[model samples]
Target: MAFPRVSILPLLLLLLITPFSSSLSLSDTITKDSLYQLCSQPTIRKHFCIIWLTNDPTTFTLNFYGLLGLVIQKTQLYGYKNLAMMKSLVRTTTDPMLKIPYGSCVTYYESAIKSMEEAIKFAILKKYELTSEAAGKAFSSINSCEADLAGRNTVPSDVPLRNIRFKRMCNIVRVFSDVLTAKNY
Candidate 1:
């Protein structure tokens, strides 16, 4: 005796479409992972640097304050006695290449977590103010991205991962430039 055939159309469709899923695609063209992979390829870094300098033509300006905060919080995170003793954010250049020793990664990680959380809030709010769908998606994605960044096993900024961080950095600067330049600033 043979068993009756059952309708498996839905399962077949799902399986057929699984290979073409849009789960990882970005809005326009490529995923952030693809972009980062492109960024990581040999000569792509040079191309990115060239494009960054030519297009936006600015340093990581928003992080300027955050870098200052990190410098100021050095002693708190490091248990050193002279971090806040500096004259100002700009004056703390005594050691241009001092590296934090081992055993303090977690402390710096926590400090960065707190600081980056605030920056994400600020950036998200700014994006919300733009009143555009693109901005909203970008900002929402940023919230998730930053959350992932904070959840890393190591300090996010130094983590050797491939993702949207570089692209988003360039986007922030480029978009901000577009805003300022459009407004005659």
Candidate 2:
């Protein structure tokens, strides 16, 4: 009985690709888990970190820089939303004192949003130090707004609490930026 000849080229190619493919998949799993672990580090809201980081399908493939960009964008969106809410409150409020605080809160949110935008731009430019600084500014603005409201005991209902949560998210981003810069990741 005679057997048909099998091309050695196909077998050789399979042998060459198998290890690389397996390693690639293994690396992906490792990255995903490690990224999740990293998110849990500084943020008090572990669930929020996990959900926010994992909600986007593209997040699993993102490096630290890309994750920082995503955080900046989300924080900016939160700031804008809070700004609009403050504006609405200011418009509808009857108390002059409330108007002053609301107006100030609006300005703070706007400033935070701007800083977040700057952070995103810096991240895109691969300037991690600038990105981290901008993010810190954004975080400070959020905290300032919350502090101002709290000092006066006139927080816009849930705005202070929301700001605290947003600050935590920004904190996570900022910490990652610092770590990545320090370690040259």
The number of residue pairs in model 2 that clash at the backbone is: 0
User: Please, what's the RMSD in Å of model 2?
Assistant: 9.0
lDDT by residue for model 1 (28-129), tens: 333334333323323234455334333432322323223222222321232121112211211433333212212133233334334434444543454322
Instruction: Name the TM-score of candidate 2.
Output: 0.75
Residue range 63-125, candidate 2, lDDT tens digits: 555666777787777777778888998899876777877888888888888888888888788
Query: How many clashes show up per model?
Result: 0, 0
Q: State the local distance difference test value for candidate 2.
A: 0.72
Name the runs in model 1 displaced over 4 angstroms: 1-100, 127-185
Error of 1 at 147 (Å): 25
lDDT of 1 at 151: 43
